[model samples]
Structures are given as C-alpha cells and as structure tokens.
Target: MKKKLGAYLTNRKIMATALLALTLALSACGNSGEKANEGSADKETRDITIKIGYQKYGTINILKADGALDKRLSEERNIKIEWIEFPGGPQLLEALNVGSLDLGHTGEAPPIFAQAAGAPLVYLAHEPASPQSEGIIVPKGSPIKSVADLKGKTVVLNKGSNVHYLLVKQLEKAGVDYKDIEVKFLPPADARAAFEKGSVDAWVIWDPFLAAAQTATGGTILVDGTDVVSNHEFYLATRAFAEKYPDIVDILLEEADKIDVWSKDHPQELAEKLSPQLGIDVESLLLAAGRRNYGVQPIDEELIKAQQAIADTFFNLELIPKKLDINDAILK
Candidate 1:
C-alpha cells in the first residue's frame, strides 16, 4: 500500500510539470502572434501616403497633371501620392503649419510669415527669381502710368505675398509713400474684378493671374520685379518631416528638378497642358510660362541673406507680427 501511494505521488508530480509546460507553450504562441501583429502595425505606419501641397500658379500643377511623380514614387517605394491644392501661397503655408500638409511650395514672403507665426518649417529648395512673372499692372488707358501715380489711388494686392514686397519696394523706389496709397487687400480673383471695373486703380499680382489679367483686361505692366525683390519660389517641408524622412525629401527634390527641366524645355506643351487644367487661355498660359524661371536651385548664403532681408522688411513695416530668423527656417 505504501509503494502504491508513492507511485501515485510521483505520477501526480509528473502531471503537474506537463501542465505547466503546456501553459508556457501556449503563452509563447500567443506572444508570437502579438509580436507579428505589432510588426505589421509598424510597417503600416511607415508606408503611408505622402501629402503634397501646391498652388495653381506654378509648375507643380504641371508636374501633378503629368503623373510622373505619382508613378515614380508609388512604384519605387509602394507609397501613395496625395495632392492638395491651395488658392495662394499664404493659404498653402497655413495648411502646412496645421499638419495637414507635409510638403509645399510658396513664395519667399509666405515662409517668413509662417516662421513668424511659429510654424515649424524647412526650406528644401528654391526656384530662381522669375521677376517678370509678377508685375504691378494698370488697366489699359488708365492714367496710372507709373508707380508714383499709385499714390492716393486705391491699389489692390494680395497681402503677405511676394508681390506685397514688390509693391512696397516699387513704392519706395518711386518715392511714393506706402501710407499714401489706399491699399485694398484682396485675393487675385477679387482684385482682378476690381481692376477690370476700374474700382481699383492698380493691381499688383503674380502669374498666371498677372498674365490672365493682362490678357482679359488689356492691362499694362507699370513696374515688374526686375531690379527689386527676387520673388523666389520656395519648396518647403515641415522640420519634423524633413528630419524624420530625409530620404523622401531627396526624392521630392529630384522629382522637382526633373519637372523644372521639362517645363523649361517644353513651354508650348506646358501651356497647352496647363490651359485646360487651369481654365485659363492658352495664350495667357504661354505668356505666364515663358516669363517664369522654372529652374530649381539649392539654397546658398546669398539666397539666405536675400530671404532675411525680406523678413526684416516685413517686420519693420509691422506687416508680420514679429521678427524671425530666416536661418532657423532653413534645413541644415
């Protein structure tokens, strides 16, 4: 009876050990499943749609319509391209600041205002100044022959834009006090309407609006940005995005460079392509395309200094809320 009891005790110990081992094995399998799910979740986070913001007035639209960027980026990395349209640079930068846009392009002044507004931004590349692309224009047969003629006259412009600086510099150059001009702040569409109806004596605008306005209203250029502001177009990304996904930044720059070259080489084709997409006349699109400098360049010290000057100009005029370091916005 003692031997049988001892044997029973040994069997009981063996059963307990087997049960413990089975429980551990089941837990291990569960852990492996969880880990596999976690890995998949991480990959989903990494491979996401890249959101790009662009305005209607530039070559970015041309690139978008071409579908090259979509094919190249999507096929190469299995990523998706999402394009967001903005009315103007200021609006685009606003979206960028709010985390809605990861990448965008804007004029020199928009980035300055964006940085002053405490937006985390980095300048990725620049389009050389296309001075002729923007102009302070007057209606046909209007008496406003010169920038000085704009004094005491209601002049309409898009506030906080590249042309804003142009208006300021042109006024200063003409010895017309900026305070003397009855400035009407409006977007391109409204300003164009005002210009045509003779409600506004002058309209300061950029391309294709400049081209469209001139074509539609027979307006003449009073003064363009030839010797004044660079009117440099800037490609920007969130500082966080730039730091986190530098490889993507390189891809963007590469694609942009290719588009720039293509646009320059095929102005007529570009105009034809953009005409229907933008709903503007082909002639106007051609004129707008011809004047623009579609060349993409890396930021240099000279460009940085030029940008800083714009920042200082706006701050001194109390246009922007405060002064900001342009260098802070440049990617290292």
Candidate 2:
C-alpha cells in the first residue's frame, strides 16, 4: 500500500512539472509573436519627412508662418516638414534639381529654365497673375523716364526670375530691342544696391522689393507687368517625390489654398504676419499684400499655353539651351 501511494505521488509531481514547462513555453511563444507585431507597427508608424523650399515672401512663406501645414501633416499623416529658404526662384529650382528639395514655389520663368536644363520637375498649382506686383523702377531723380528710354542704358534684374519675362515683354512693347539695353543680371539685394548707387539705370524687380524700393528710394515705376506678362506664381515638385507621395502633394496644395483664402480676406493681418518673416516693414509689406492676387488654381490649358509662350520666347532669344514644352513639366 505504501509503495503504491509513493508511486502515485511521484507521477503527480512529474505531471505538474510538465504542465509548468508547457505553460512557460507557450508564454514565450506569445511574447515572441507580440514582439514581431510591434516591430512591424514601428515600421508602419515611422514618420516621413518632406523637404520644402520657399522664398522670403509669398504664399509658401505665409503657409510656413501659419504653421497649419506642419500641424495637419503631423497629426493626420505622421509626416514631418523641413522648410528651406532660397534667395530667388532660380536658386530654389536648382535645389530641386539636386534632390535637396521635394517641393518649392517659383514664378513662371525659373521652371522654364530648369526644365530646359533637364530638371525633372512637375508643376502642381499656380496663383493667378498679379500684374502690379512687379515693375521696372528708377531712382527718384533718375533721367530714365520710360521703358523706351532704357535704350543703351544699364538695367539690372534677377536672371531667370518672373521679372525676367516682365522686362522682356515691357521692352518689346516699348519697341526696344533686347540687345539694345545693357542688361545686368543681379539678385534682388545686389540689384537694389546698384540701383541705390546709380550704377544701374533701372531695376526690374518684384514686390516686396518693388514696394521697398519705391518706399525707401521714392523710385518711379517705369513699367509694371500690367497688360504685359502673367506673373504667375507656381508650386513645383520633383517627379519622383510627386509620384511616390501624391497624397502629401495634395495636402500641401490644399493647405496653401486655405492660406490664400485667409490672406485675401485679411490684407492687414497678412502684412503684419509677413512683415517679420520678410524683414520688410509693415507698410511695404502692406503694399505688396494689397497688390497680390491670392488664389491657388490647378494648371489648365490656357495657363499652359501662356507658359509655353514664355518658353518659346526664351528659346527664340537663345536664353535657354533647348526648347521646352511646358506641358512636359506639368503634373497630370
């Protein structure tokens, strides 16, 4: 009887030990499976960073200042934004070419030159032409009175900028040959310096620089873009970036449109917000904000044709190495 009882106890102890081991093994397997799922979740939730290039002033600046883009992209998509500022559109497009920027804003001309230079860019949207936003200005007491009077005189402008097309068209209207004037290609800062020193006969510039020049120097407007050029501001992105993350592009445009709506309704508030970002006083910024026509529209047939005309003009003048079909750079 004692041997049988001992045998039963031994068997029971063995069964208990086996059960404990099995429980621990199952728990370990469950932990491993959980870890695998967590790894996948980490991968899926990783944040995406988008690099955006912008100029000193414009809707992009307003967008950046508003902080709505960053907030929306972060909360909704787990995406991060990186903002880069360029001196001008040409420089911005150059960064796009080198893959440093995923998206950026520019006036009409820079993209044309960039496209001709083989930058794989796609236009996303554009602001309607704000003709009075840019102009040719001479100092307060300069002898140069009209666009036609710029003949054989030195004119400074940012090369391959929106104002570049403006200068060309205005000169054509005044019956001045492109070669007749001594053209000096300088960025806005340098051009303004030269203008102040009377080194350049006239400065072809866009606002807030135009407004600043006019306010500070009391310069007279020789000719603005009125009835001359459609100085459209474009939103551009690299082909790869746009193709891989189209949703991000759409979000950006949507946010920009929102800012545009807000800006158009609140000019004083817009100027106040932009004054610090642009480093221009509120008055000049107000002038710039006033003249600016704000709206974000998709690239359409008429817009494309207008852009193509600019491209053709550049090609005919040998400003670009090759002719460009503006449609090629447009987002489908």
Candidate 3:
C-alpha cells in the first residue's frame, strides 16, 4: 500500500509539472503574437513629413501664410509641413535635386534647367500666364526706351529663370541677337541693387519684385511679357514623392486652388494680408496682385509644346549641356 501510494504521488507530480510547462509555452507564444501585432499597428500609424521649397512671393507663400494646408494635412493625414524659402527658382530646384525638398514652385525656365541637370522632377500644375507680371525695366529717366535699345547694353536678370525666356524672346522679337547684349546673371536682390545703382542698363524681372522695383526705384518698363512668353508659375514635386504620395499632392493643389479663387476676388484683402509678411507696402503688393492671373491649370499637350520650345531654345543656345525632352519630367 505504501509503494502504491508513493508511485501514485510521483505520477501526480510529473503530470502537474508537464501541464505547467505547456501552459508557460502557450503563454509565451501569445505574448510574442501580441508584440508582433503591436509593431504592425505602429507602422500603420507612422507620421509623414513633407518639406516644401518656396520663394518669398507667389501662391506657395500665400498658401503657407494662409495656414489651410498645415491645418488640413495635420488633422486629416497626420502629415507635417516644413516650409523652406529660396532666393530663386534655380536654387529651389537645386534643393529638390538633392532630396532636400519634396515640392517647390518655379517659373517655366527653372524646370527646364533642372530636368537637363538630371533632377527627378514632375510637374503637378501651373498658374496661368500673367504676362504683365514680368518685364524688362530701366531706370525711370534712362534713354533705353524699347527692347531694341538693349543692343550692346548691359542687362541683368536671374539666369535660368522664367524671365530668361522672356529676355531671349523679347530680344529676338526686337531683331537683336542674344549675344549682342551683355547679360549679367544675378538673383533678384543683387540684380535689383545693380539696377538701382545704374550698374546695368536694364533689368529683366518678375513681380512682386517687378512691382516693388517700380515703386522703390521708379523703374520704367521697357517691355512686359505680354506678347512673349507665358510666364507660367509651375508647382513641381520630386518624382518619387509624387508617385509615393499622390493623395498628398492632390490635397495641396486643391488647397492652392481655393486660395487662388479667393485671391482673384479679393485683391485688396490679399495685398493687405501679405504686406507685413512680404515687408512691402500695400500699394506695391496690390499692384503685384492685380496683374497676376490666379488659377491652377492641368498640364496639357499645348502647354507641353510651349515648355518644349523653351527647352529647345536653351539647347540651341548651348545653355544646357544636353537636349531634354520636357515630357519625360512631366507627371503622368
């Protein structure tokens, strides 16, 4: 009876130990599974950040000041925006090239130059040609009355800028060879300083700089982009970013369109709002705002042809190292 009891107790101990070990193994698996699920959830809810490059003026600036983009993206998509200011489109596109910027706005010529340099850029949308928004100007009292007068004279402009096409076309139309005029490549601020000091005979510039220059220095317009280039303001994104987050791009465009509509209807109000930010007086801001064409349009075949023309002109002039197909950089 003692042996039987002892054997029975030994059996009970073995069974209890086995059950405990099995329970511990099952519990360990359950904890591991829970941890795996938690990691996946964290990935699904990861936050994204978009870095935007913008100039001191234009729709992007207005968008930044408006706060609509920030609010909507933050609340809806858990996305954050970082705005970076560039001196000019060329600089902005350079930032886009090195992966520093996800999106940026520029005039028509910058993208052509950027694409030629192998920047992976995609055109998203464009503001209509505001012909009067850009021009070739001289000091108020200068005798350089027309574009024809620019022959053999010093002209300052931002190189590879939207106004570059304007200068070329304007010179061509006026029967002056591009090489006949002395061209000084400078950003707007430096170009403005040169213009004010009479160091350059003429300055080709775009507004609100154009407007500000006229007001500040009493410069006279030799020729605006009226019958020349379209002077379209383009919104561009890195090809990778556009492809990966198209929905974010769409939201940005939608918000920009809303601002454009409001800007068109409320020029005075827009000027007043931008005055302090731009540090320009309301009068000049109003002047710049007045002539601006305020609508974002999709890229079309006609627009592509226009852009291609600019590219071809640059290639022919040997401004770019190689010929570029504008369509390749365009977003499909």
Residue-by-residue lDDT tens digits, candidate 1, 140-226:
999878888887999898777888889989998999888998999897778888888989898889999999988888889998999
Candidate 2, 116-184: lDDT as tens digits: 989999998788789999999999988888888999999999999999999999989999999999999
Candidate 1's displacement at residue 263, Å, is 1.1
lDDT of 3: 0.87
Q: Write the per-residue lDDT of candidate 3 for residues 77-98, one digit (tens) a residue.
A: 6888999999899999999999
With a 3 Å backbone cut-off (N, CA, C), the pairs that clash in candidate 3 are none
The backbone clash count of each candidate, in order, is 0, 0, 0
The list of candidate 2 runs beyond 4 A from truth reads 1-46
Instruction: State every prediction's TM-score relative to the real structure.
Output: 0.86, 0.86, 0.87
Q: What ranking of all candidate models by lDDT puts the best one first?
A: 3, 2, 1
Off by over 4 Å in 1: 1-46
Q: How does each model score on lDDT? A: 0.81, 0.86, 0.87
Compute the lDDT of residue 128 as modeled in candidate 3. 86
